[model samples]
Each structure stands twice: as C-alpha cells, then as structure tokens.
Target: MALPDMDTSVGHSFGLEVDGIQIKQISEVSGLKMEQDVIELKQNTADGKYVIKKLPGRPKAGEVTFTRGLTSDNSFEKWIKDCHFGKMSDARKGGAVIVYDFEGNPIKRYKLTNAWAKSLEISTLKAGDTSVLTEKLVVTYEQMEAE
Candidate 1:
C-alpha cells in the first residue's frame, strides 16, 4: 500500500505589508480574529414543539495588533497623525498578513481592507534603563478575508 501525500507546511509570521509596501522588523502580530454573528430563530412546529436554530448573520473581524522594535522609520507615526486629523481618504490602507512554508513559499494569506490605525503606544522610557524600545499599534479593518 502507498502512503498518501501529507501537508507539512509551517507558518511564517513576520512578512507583512500595507498598501503594497513591506513593513520591517515586526516581531509579533496578534488579535487577528475573523468572526460572524449568530442569529437565533425560535420556530414552532405543527406538533407544538419549539426549537432554536442558529444562522449566520454578518462578518465581524476584530482588530489586529502589531509589535516591533523601534527603528529610525517614522512612516507609521506619520500615518497615524494623518488619520487623527481626519484625512481618512489618505490614511486608510489595504494590507495583508502572509504565512509562508519553510521553502519560502506563501501558504496562506489574510487580506485586510480599509484598515487604519486605532492607537499607537510606545514602551515606557527611563533615563537609566537598558531595555529595548518597542512600538505597539492597534489596527481596525472594515473587512478581512482569508485565502
């Protein structure tokens, strides 16, 4: 008997892009959730028995958070400011979270639409501390689809 082919691809977490431009040095990505609302319907049958049925309602993708060591790049900060000033047309961006196999081939992709930064936070600074500086960003998206 011959054995069937099995999938053994590993996930790659660091390759991310926004508006087709690659973001660098991202160490962690979290809070990526795709959810759908459930609608319950209670119906009575002719036998006088009531039952509840669950139906899919709408798509509700949660926010995504990115954490990275601070670098010389200020593009993200600029973009956040632009969004704060009500320049949504320019602030909104399309992004993708990609997962690759060990051979460097893309295995999965999560496409994000109309995404904008919800908040940006920097690690606390101390005069004599020797910790690495980091930036954390919270992002919200209008839609997300996995392929």
Candidate 2:
C-alpha cells in the first residue's frame, strides 16, 4: 500500500465501560489488509528530536475479524496491558502521551496507545501474504488489553 497524505487525523479510538476497554478505527477509502504495520511519528520541532510509535501489525488476515462495534473480541483490548505500553510511553519521552482518542473515558486507566499511520490505502488486503511494508514497520507494542 502506498502512503496517504499527511492527514493529521486518520482514525479515532474509544474507551467503553464494558469488555471493550479501548477501540480504534481508520476508515479505508480502499481496504484494510492484515499483517501491515502502522507507525505514529512524533517529531519534535524544537530540536528535530523524533520518536516512532508503531502499533502491532495486523494479525494475518482471517486471524482476526473486524466488527461494527467495540467488543472483547477486539484484539487491541487483549494486548494493551503488557510492557509494550511502557515502551510506547517511553518513546514519547517528555510529553504526556496518554491515549487521547478515547478522551474522557475512564477506561484509559490501562496505559493505552493509538495513532494514525502516514496512510496505506493503496495497499491490498492479503492474508498469509507478506509485503515489504511489514519490514519498514515493526511491532512496537504487543497489543491493547480488554476489560
């Protein structure tokens, strides 16, 4: 998939009071394939200091399914509580990098992380298939946790 223009906001995340503690969704004008990695770049304008915030790659297609609403079934909720959260937090360094997408939601208590990648709409959705994009990308975090 080719990169999409720098749209500061590509998707959104939400935290609930039920099994689905946190959720993020990026609309695909094209299609969202699995196994592709997404990165959130944090560049400091003051000194050009930047950090890469990468989310775990999408599980191979068919390994997981996307649903209409947030639920325990969501993979993010199942992997956010691990050390990866700390890693992502550390990457941000001096600022308050808490998950803001789920703004005002108490479920944010679980060290959450969500951000948009440059854009990969031109990419195709393929399962069990690998692409060069996966290499440029890395699984910076494990997964988000579920309530």
Candidate 3:
C-alpha cells in the first residue's frame, strides 16, 4: 500500500480585510488572546483535611490591535467619528478579519461582533525623516468567533 501525500504548504500573512475593506500596507496584527478565571473552593472533610476544589469561570477575549501605514483615504477616521459622534442610530458595526494564505486563499476568519474602535494612534512626524506615516487601531468587541 502507498502512503498518502501530505500537504506541506504554509500560510502567509500578507493580506487581511476588515468589514469588506481592503487595508493597505498592514505592518502587524496582534492581540488574539483569551483568558479564563480559576475559582478555588475549600471545604472541611471527615478525613481531617481540607478538600480543595477548582472551578472555571467565564472566558474573556482581549482587545485586538492592527497596525498599518497611514493612507491618503480618511475612511478610518470617518468611521471613528461616526462611532462616537454620528447622529444615526446603530452606529456600531460588526466586522470580520480574514487572513489569507500564501496563495491568497482564505485560511481563517475572526468575526467581531459589535466592534468599535477603542483607540486610534498616528505615528509621530519628524522634520528630517523618511519614514512612512503609520496608524495604530485598537478595537474592542463584545465577542469573537473563529471560522
């Protein structure tokens, strides 16, 4: 019998999309973390020893951060303004972060429910530097689902 060939392809981190928008020149994406609380209970037993019990609590998702070079478009800034100052109802929007493979195929996606921009930072400017302007966006979401 012949052995089946295994796929040795690796996924690349070249492109990502948020809310159906193509983000240009993404430097890095971090903060995909989840944590849970541990609860301990102590009880007295007939064996003259204390019995310790461990319980697991709810899990929490951490804030996700996306860093990229600043672009000419002001859509991100407008989105921030709409989230905080827009007169329209239901300003918050849910988005998805789709990661692509080396061949530009979709590998994984994280759906962010009720996501809003928690913070936005612009890179500092200098008089005699040749660095590209960059922006950092931190988003907070109610829940995240991996698909």
Candidate 4:
C-alpha cells in the first residue's frame, strides 16, 4: 500500500468570514471544539470481582472566539448590539466560519446555528507604544457543523 500524498504548502489561519462578511486582518481564531460526556458504570461480578463500563452521553459544542485588528467600520459593534440589545426577534443569527488555504481557497468550513455574541472586548491603548487596535469577540451557538 502507498501512503497518500501530503500537502506541504503552509496553510494560514488569517482568512475568516462570519455570515458572509469578510473579516480582514484576523490575528487569531479559536475554540472550535466538541466534547462528549462519558458515563461510567461499576458493577460487582461473581467471585468478588469488580467491573467497570464506560458509555457515551451527550455531546456539546464549545464557544468560538475571534480576534481581529480593529477597523473603522462598526459592523462588529452592531452585530454585538443586535445580539444583546436589539429587538428579541432580530437576535441570534446563524453564521459560518471558513478557513482558507495559503492560495486563498476554502479548505474547511464550520456552520454556526443560532449564534449570538457572548462577549466583546477591545485592546487597551497606550500613548507611547505603537500597536494596532484589536477586538476580541466570543460567541455561543446552539450547534456547529463542519461542511
């Protein structure tokens, strides 16, 4: 048997989109995780022997976090407000995050169902230091699917 061909080109985590909006200059994206609960059962068998069995329980999706360089646009702020302060009917929008290869091709995509912003933060500014302003956003969703 022959091994499958490996891709050597470096893939970047920079390109990301949220609900069809292109987010540029993203520094970090994290928390694409899923976990399942494990149920352990203990039983006593014959001859005073003990046995343990494990079973799978419910599955959960973790929160997704995005960090990007701040820009002049207020889209992210508006989105956050919509989730927190806007009309209840307009909140909780579904979105997606696309990961691209170095050549600007989509390699993996994650769909977020009924997502809402849980928290938003801005980087601190200093008078003497030169640094780009950045925004950090954390979002929670009902479900996440890989496409």
Best by TM-score: 1
RMSD of each: 3.5, 20.6, 4.3, 3.6
Candidate 2: regions farther than 4 A off: 1-104, 112-122, 125-138, 142-147
Please write out the lDDT profile of model 1 over residues 1-147, one tens digit for every residue.
222258654444447889999898888889888898999999998999999999999998679998889999996798789899999999999999877766566667789999998899999999999999999989899888887
How close is every model to the real structure, measured as TM-score? 0.90, 0.16, 0.77, 0.81
**Model 3 stretches astray by more than 4 angstroms:** 1-15, 86-90
Tens digits of per-residue lDDT, candidate 2, 91-147, equal: 321111122232343322222133212211123447886642211111222233322
Look at candidate 2 and give me any clashing residue pairs: 1-123, 76-144, 77-145, 77-146, 79-143, 79-144, 80-143, 80-144, 80-145
Assess candidate 2 and give its lDDT. Answer: 0.30
lDDT of each: 0.85, 0.30, 0.71, 0.76
Where is model 1 more than 4 Å wrong at Cα?
1-5, 8-12
lDDT of 3 by residue, 1-147 (tens): 212256433434645456667767777877865567788998988988989999997767557888888988676677667767853244456677777655666666778777777678999999998998988888777778888
Off by over 4 Å in 4: 1-5, 8-11, 45-48, 86-88
Could you tell me how far off, in angstroms, the CA of residue 110 lies in candidate 2 after the best superposition? 3.6
Better of 3 and 4 by lDDT: 4
Best by lDDT: 1
Candidate 1: C-alpha lDDT? 0.85
